[model samples]
Target: MRCLYCAHAMGLATCPLGTVVPILNRPENADILDLLNIPKDYEVAINMALGYPTESPEPPIRYSDKIKIVL
Candidate 1:
């Protein structure tokens, strides 16, 4: 379905060397839909906040302590 594609796109945006974010806000999607004047048939699938990140992103935290590296 189209929703799945939207989710996949969002996931890809957050993947390594990518830029995209989808965060939940205090207001509900209905509120946004009303403001954006999106047709009732449509819905706000993903709400994103765009801006220059204040600080450099840190690498994902890993569990190197328990897992053994087999190189």
Candidate 2:
């Protein structure tokens, strides 16, 4: 999960591609794992896919006033 989060953050910082998390039980999961030569002893927890965006989206507005800071 931590690795997935770091990869997501890095992707967001470095590229325009969007990230997708595929279901673990999908039929292609095994094939993908095999193709990647991942060890059989390890289980797939999360699968992420990165791809180019087809359209531009408006940036979401942030409400900083709603956030509270505590020390």
Candidate 3:
């Protein structure tokens, strides 16, 4: 994640307003719209329907040929 709003990374956590604000989850209507004051130009990288995973996904099998360095 980019440290744009993180005070610890920027060394401003002690400042008055630099203390971070929490964005609360909003319901699915006009209330959510007001909560998220996203600009027109902004875009969401990921949007998820949050829930516990019923099954654990296995890691992909790695191929040995891909490990060689050409240089």
Candidate 4:
């Protein structure tokens, strides 16, 4: 998870390891690769979105009321 340069950069300044999104929806979208000029030998296994949060997220729903717990 730690590449030499990545570790170095992170050490120098906190690199917000942003949200990791998958290319599941558009796996076959070669436009991204073309845009980036990525060679055919390589492939995009994962994707990421980096930015500051716009607002606080909604609270998670509690399953306690919905699903019966069986111990």
Candidate 5:
């Protein structure tokens, strides 16, 4: 999986418009809302670290439609 942005994980209780601060000046233990001074109900997407397959993966069995011009 790849890394994704999550406000809650970043110490933010709520984020508006899924906007996450590129840089936070508050401590890691501090809540993101407290740092940003945002009201309640604010939410932002989550930043997550995901690991994808190291090697190329084959397509599913139903992918035959992708071959429009078969030689």
Candidate 6:
């Protein structure tokens, strides 16, 4: 999860920020893991596809305004 987050941050830092799509468990993924020689004991965390955006959308409004800070 940490690695995925780091990769996601880097991907988003591009000139035209790219989207990071996470791929979960799939039968073909097992073959890929084997090809990469990833140990069976270790599970695949995330498979991300980074690419430019096709459509531009407004950023979601964060609800941080509602959170109260306790000093």
The deviation in Å at residue 7 for candidate 4 is 10
Runs in model 2 deviating more than 4 A are: 1-32, 62-71
> In candidate 6, residue 46 scores what lDDT?
44
- Candidate 4 residue lDDT tens string, 1-71: 34534644544322333233245225676677778887766766544433444454564657868876553
lDDT per residue as tens, model 1, 1-71: 45444654555222221132122222444565667677767644454433334455655657978876563
What TM-score would each prediction reach against the true structure?
0.37, 0.37, 0.28, 0.34, 0.20, 0.38
Query: Residue-wise lDDT of candidate 5 within 1-71, one digit each (tens)?
Result: 12233543444343233233433323462487666565545543443333443454554566566755453
Top candidate, metric TM-score: 6
Model 3 over residues 1-71: C-alpha lDDT tens digits?
23333543554322232122222222233354355775434433433233334554564556756775443
Better candidate by lDDT, 1 or 6: 6
For candidate 2, write residues 1-71 as lDDT tens digits. 46555755665322422233345435567776678787767666555555444555765556758965553
Let me know the TM-score candidate 5 reaches against the reference structure: 0.20
User: What does candidate 6 score on TM?
Assistant: 0.38
Model 3 lDDT at residue 40 = 39
lDDT of 2: 0.54
Q: How good is model 2 by TM-score?
A: 0.37
- Candidate 4 Cα RMSD after full superposition onto the native fold (Å): 9.6
Ranking by TM-score: 6, 2, 1, 4, 3, 5
Worst 10 residues of 5 by lDDT: 14-23
User: Could you tell me how far off, in angstroms, the CA of residue 23 lies in candidate 6 after the best superposition?
Assistant: 9.9
Evaluate all candidate structures by whole-model CA lDDT and list the values in order: 0.47, 0.54, 0.40, 0.51, 0.43, 0.53
Model 1, runs deviating above 4 Å: 1-31, 63-71
lDDT of 6 by residue, 1-71 (tens): 45555654665422321232123245556766688787877666545455545565665656769965453
Q: How many clashing residue pairs are found in candidate 5?
A: 13
